[model samples]
Target: MDVDEERQRSLKRSLLCLCAAELVMMVNTTAFNVALPNIAESLGAGMAEQQWIVSSYNLVFAAVVLLAGFMGDRLGHLRTMIAGLGMFVVASAIGLAAGNVPVLLVSRSIMGAGAGVVIPMGQALLGILFRGPALSRAMTAWAIAGTLGVPFGPLVGGALTATLGWRGIFGFDGVVFLAVIAVIRMNVPRTGGSRKSRSLHVPWASVAMMFAGFTLFSAGLVNAQHGVLTAGAWMPMAVGAALITGFVLHDRASRNPLMELGLMRDPSFAACAPALMMLNFSMYGIIFIMPAYLETVLRHGALIGGMLLMPLVVASIAGARMNDRIVSRIGPRGTSLLALGCLAAGMLTIGAAMWWPDGMMRQSTVLVGQLMAGLGLGAGQPAMLTWAMGRVPIGQSGAGSSLLTVFRQFGSIIGVGIFGSIQSGLYTAEFHDLAQSAGLAPQSAGSVTLDFQRAADMTGMTGDLMRQAASRAYESAMTGSFAAAAAVIAATLGVVALISRRTPR
Candidate 1:
């Protein structure tokens, strides 16, 4: 083979390896949610601890991910990825050995740090690796890796938790990281920094503000379960908002901002922000709530819940593969509108499913909704990202990719938090009335309410009457949450409609 052919083969191998690592990163992120229940039981964790367990990683991930992309740009994508993999491996090992909630939370936060670095670097590197049609295909695979991770996470987590216990999930992650590291070392080519990269200074003030803002915002949102008026629910959010505002002002003034603030000037890039946010808001919102819904209302086991969720993952992968052709034929705007419509329809379907008393009907309807939502997100996200990137210069792909990733992650943070609050609020209100009508004493009612407070786990409700009430309350709460998601999708569709076709392709 000629030297050019040899180099092409190596690049393909490297892309595959990087994609594999990306897949594993997603698996680890999503699988942890499935394992949370098991971890709570094993470690005797409280409701607050469980919330932290899940949100810590996300909080940390969102805080540092932007910086990770800059590191990839300045240092090297491959080197950053390797560092992330090594950190992930160590973090997983720590999680496997964790004897308490704090240790596990620390481990998860560390893992998120690694994943934050890895995720943006992977996307940045992919931009560097391919061009034109090849870039489209590579991004399709990348999108598949991401969307596949969401549903597959529960599947893998359920299987691992059922068979080898929750620790097995962490152990599996460690193994995946190790294998990916080997592939990275063998296949990926080294990339040098740009000449102008050294002149670019890291905006430490903006970084701190961004990190503090997200962390506090997350803390506040997670605390919303306490009640919207409570200090836990609003104070941190207030502080976070202020910090984020400060960051925006600082970024506007900086000579070399962390991300290209000017990208929003392009209509296509501007649209991608909320468009991707809404996509993830719908997708992750459901993923956040479904495991509990499956186990509680439908009374499915973890493994079975995972199996039922498989159609979503499978459909997402199919949608991503089909998107390239669809966009080419229908144009980007048409494809986007259709995807948004599908998402709105899916949310409505799921909401309707919640009202059904019959198990078979509810499951089937939910399955259909899952498929629709997955396909919509799978198609819409890749198109939005591609469109946004087209507007970006090749030199700034890392920053561009980072901004996109942060938008998605930000959406996830808000989606999960908002949905959880909706469910918890609705469930609490409904359950109280149900419990009172059931003629339980105030003390008994309080205990039962506390048991179902998180709205994620129904294990504590023992008697048939309590279980029945819990299920009914859960179903109602989920319906309200789904309706909220549908509204978000509809609103996003309206925003997408405003983007003119005259924008650069």
Candidate 2:
């Protein structure tokens, strides 16, 4: 074959391999949402532990992403991606077969590490394979694969859970992971980049700092539910603050820092990072909390909740396509501001709907609000990422993009942990107050609390009183959580406004 034909064939194969890898990684992050309740039941997890199921994955994933990018630069993207895929496959198998919660957590953490390796390197490889419009289109396709995977995950996951069980999702992932490896091996070219003499070290100190900071913050939020405060919680938070301070200084002074601190000093890059962070924070919060609301409040099954989320996914895809057109016209700054406004408005609308009396109408109103939020998220995310990278030099694009990805994932971890805590706290407090107002004895109230917790584990309540109490507690908790999430989104809007105003137009 001629050179042109060979090049076209090579590009097609590489893009397909990249798309498969992207899809698997995205699915790994999102498919578990549908299984969370089932997982909790099986493991007998409380609110905090359940939150860890998601946060643990995101925490390790985000923490390691920067280092993964550095590894790709030194060790070759193809090699890094293949190794990640292998780890992902092993982790998936472990998760699928594990009988205990700790094992599952370990499996998830390993999966996150694998994801860290695959995603950044995959993007870097795409950069190597294509250029100009072809490159842009390829990258856009990757983004679409990843974003749409969130919505699609529930559909696939829910169906699998309904048909087979929660474990099926992980088993499916394992199979898909192997498929990705095969695709990469068969199709992707083995290209080599420069091996700079950068640190092969994993920056354990910085990782520990982030881990401590997030853990303390998450513990504080979780403790808020029990109406309890202890030194353990606050101490971690203080240490976290200190560690973060030290981390910043370390990054600045290190020859090859985990992150390039100087890039953050750029006003445009700085502004975009927070906006992207807030957007993902809100996105994951809704994803994490909405299913519970549907299951407990609306009396829907996992499949139904997944279906209800479909519109948001569809709107997001439409919004992402529209973003490409508008970014050139309004520029990234204006487009982002507009998107943020839409997000804030959408969140406020949902919050207002939650204040309505519980009914079908209230549910409908909230779903509308979700669609609006999804639209804003879809438009804002692509523009923010593209704009953030665009402002930096081509050579630094990987680092810049990786930083944004890290912050976004960190936002996801924080969002889930905080919102889960808020929901748990609100539920516990209101349930106790309601019991008192109903003239229940103190001993009876304690029994009711035990019953409620047990009801979450088992399928049915043996007594009418227990069922009624559990239902009230669950609804109250979900409503309070949604309201708090709305406030968080509102705070995000204010933050975006301040940041965008100062961002160079």
Candidate 3:
């Protein structure tokens, strides 16, 4: 074979390794959802703690990723990736040994920082290796790898948690990343230490502003569980909004903005970006809500909960397979409307299922809804993604992509934070009333309300009352959360419908 052919084969191997690394990152993001209940049981975590343990990572990741591209450019993509992987390996070790909630949260945030660095650098490396047709194909592989983690994450997480316990999730990430790092050292061709680019500008102020804004914003929303009227809830929210506004103004005024804000001026992009955001919101919300419900409320084991999500998984893949053909028939606009409708319908159905008998009927309804929702998002999401990206000017595609990612990641944060706050509030109100009606003492009911596993383990009439109230409260809260997801999807549908006519075919 010619030298070029051998080079091509080696590049493909490198691509595989890089994509595998990314898949590990994505899986770690959602896999913890299945383990949240276990974590809570082990650590005595409340609603806020549970949400932050997950959101802390996302908040840092979303905030850091914008700046990570610059880091890659400065440090050299390969070198930056190695450093990030090393941090991830160390953070995962910390997570494995975490004895309490605060420590675990700190560990997750560090992991998020590593992921923020690794992902963009991984993409940068791909850009270096593949050009023209190969570049597009390589990116498509990268995108697919990221997508697969969402549906399969719970299953993988569930299996790990069941077999090796919750810490296994962290252990798995650490082990894989270490192996990937080793492979990169051995197989990936190294250029010299990467040099900083002369033309590139790093917006340190914008980075700090954006990061602070999101953190404050998400913190405020999560704090709303205490009551939106409280100082804790509204104060940070006000400041966060101010900071975010400042971020935008700063970006607009800056000569070298962190992102291409003008991409939204195109009607298609304006509509498509939020559609992607809402899609992210929907995905994050469901994964966050479901696992704890299945594991704690319904008394299903982690493995069973993971297995239960398979229909949604299978259907989503099928929907994705059909995305292109549907777009061919109805166009991207029509395709998105259909997908959002199905997504909303599924969420509503899940809400409705709680009213049914708590045995097979409830389970079947949720499963059916999962299939419907899964198919909708699966079929619809790629179309929206394609539509949004297609509208970007070739010259500005990188910045456009970054801005879209920021929107999508924030959407995930909003989903987790807002829904978490809402769920906490609903559960508290419902449990309070139920506890009062049962004549239970405030302290016992408070403990039960804080964590479902405690109620499951208690004894006697009080235990029975606690169990029932906890279960009922969780169900009620979940119902409300699903309803909110449906409402968001509905609003997104309205927005998209308004723009569909204006959207370029």
Candidate 4:
């Protein structure tokens, strides 16, 4: 083949492989939500354990990402990605054979480790392979794939779980994981990639500090269920804060910094990073609450919950597709403001649905809220990426981009932890109040509060009463939680509008 044609072919193949692999990884990030109830039932896990099941992967991913990036720089991005894929496959296998919650969590943490290695490495490889227009197009497609996978995860996961049971989801992942590995091997030529070719280095101390800091902070957030101010939550959070403070000092002093801290100086970048984080923050908060709410409070199956979320998935895709056109008319800042507004509005609408009696009107209202929030979140992402990256110093774009990714992950972890804490606390308080009013033992409230499914399964009027109380508690909790999330986004939106300079037509 001619050199030009071969180069084009190679680029196309590499881009295609990267996008598909990334889609699968991103899908797994949220897909496991569909299996939580079933997993809990089968393994006898409680609320805290279930939360960790969803959390462990994200925790591990945020913690280990820099180390993974360093490995990519040393061993070749493609090589690192493949090894990560291997880790993902094995983790899926472990998930399948696991008999207990701890074992399952161990498997998920491994998958998170895989994600850590693969995603950053994939981004690096794309940068290495493409330039200018090709690079831009590759990144857009890459971002879209990631965007679609998150909501799509629940859809695919639900279908798998409903048809094949919870283990089916893991089994399906294993199959797809193998296919991703196969596609990369078959399509990408052997001549591609390098081993230790460049001098991009990350210090081991920085890696350790970052991982520990992120992990501890998230762990503290996990304990926020007890109370954000309580010792269980605050103590760990204080230590984590200290460690993170130490990390900042160390990074500033070190010659080989893990992140491009300088990017924060750009007005657009500073606004863009936090704004994108709120998007994930809102998205993840909704994602975390809905699955448990559907499966536990409403007693719907995973498949039903997944089906209900279609409006969100569809709207997010539509918004992403419509983003460029929206930018052309209103500019990036307006588009971003519009996006956050929709998210805040959509969340409020979802919370409002609980006010209605159980019927079609309630469900339909929920769907509308999903559409609004999904559209806003989806619409803003492409613009955010393009805007932030444009301001990034050319040679340091990789580090800048990685920092943003870490930010997004941090947003996810925090959203889930804080929102989960909010829901749990409110649910328990309402349930306890009701249990006490009925003259039931406080011990009864403990199980009822922690495990909705168990409380729901008890026999007679007592069971029915607690069930009603549980449902009402969930409704009240979601209302408060959703409103809180909206308030945060709205406040952020206002700040961003003030800080970000108007985009030129």
Q: How close is every model to the real structure, measured as TM-score?
A: 0.93, 0.89, 0.88, 0.91
**Model 2 C-alpha lDDT versus the unseen true structure:** 0.71
lDDT score for residue 91 of model 1: 96
Report each candidate's C-alpha RMSD, comma-separated, in the order given.
3.0, 3.3, 3.3, 2.8
lDDT of candidate 3 over 263-374, digit per residue (tens): 8788887787777777778888889888878877777889888888878778777787777678778987888888889989998998888888657999899999999988
Error of 2 at 440 (Å): 5.7
Tell me model 3's lDDT, rounded to 2 decimals: 0.78
lDDT of 3 at 272: 74
lDDT of 4 at 205: 86
Best-fitting candidate, scored by TM-score = 1
- Kindly report which residue stretches of model 2 are placed more than 4 angstroms away from their true locations once superposed: 1-13, 127-136, 190-192, 196-202, 227-229, 438-462, 500-505
Evaluate model 4: give its TM-score.
Answer: 0.91
**Model 3 stretches astray by more than 4 angstroms:** 1-15, 72-83, 120-143, 182-201, 391-398, 442-451
Better of 1 and 4 by lDDT: 1
Candidate number with the higher TM-score (3 or 4): 4
lDDT per residue for candidate 1 within 1-505, as digits (tens), equals: 9999998898789878877887888788777777665675577664456666777777787777888777777777778779988999999899999998889989989987897788878877877887777777787888888888878898999899889999999899889899989988898887745746455477788889999998898888878876888998899999998998888888888886777778788888887787887876776677777777775456676777777788888888888989998999886677777788888888989999988878789878988998898889789867777777767776777778888878877887888788877776777788777766776431222212334443334344435556667778778888898998898889878987786456643
Ranking by TM-score: 1, 4, 2, 3
What residue runs in model 4 are displaced by over 4 Å at the alpha carbon? 1-10, 73-75, 127-136, 188-202, 393-397, 438-452, 502-505
lDDT of 3 at 368: 92
- Order of quality (lDDT): 1, 3, 4, 2
Could you give candidate 2's per-residue lDDT for residues 1-505 as a string of tens digits? 9999999999988988888788767666766887777676666666667777787788777767787776676667788789988988899889889898899999998998887778777766766666555665676677667778777777777787778788898899989989889989989987544566555766777767766666566555555544536665566556656766787787678766777667887767777787787777777777787766665445576778778778778877777778767776887788777777777667666656756665777778877887888788778876776656655554554566567777787678667866677767666676566655554421222222344455455444334444465556656666666666666766766776676676755
Residue lDDT tens for model 4, 1-505: 8999988988898888988998999788778887777776777766667678877887888777766655555555677778989998999999998888888999999998898778877766666666555655676677677778878888888888889888887788898999999999887543223344545555878877777877788778878877899888888888887887898799878776776687788778777887888887887888788887776666778888877777887898788888778877887778878898999999999988888886688878888999999898778777776667666644454455567667777778878887888877777787677667876543323322344655556778777776777777777888878888888889989888877865443
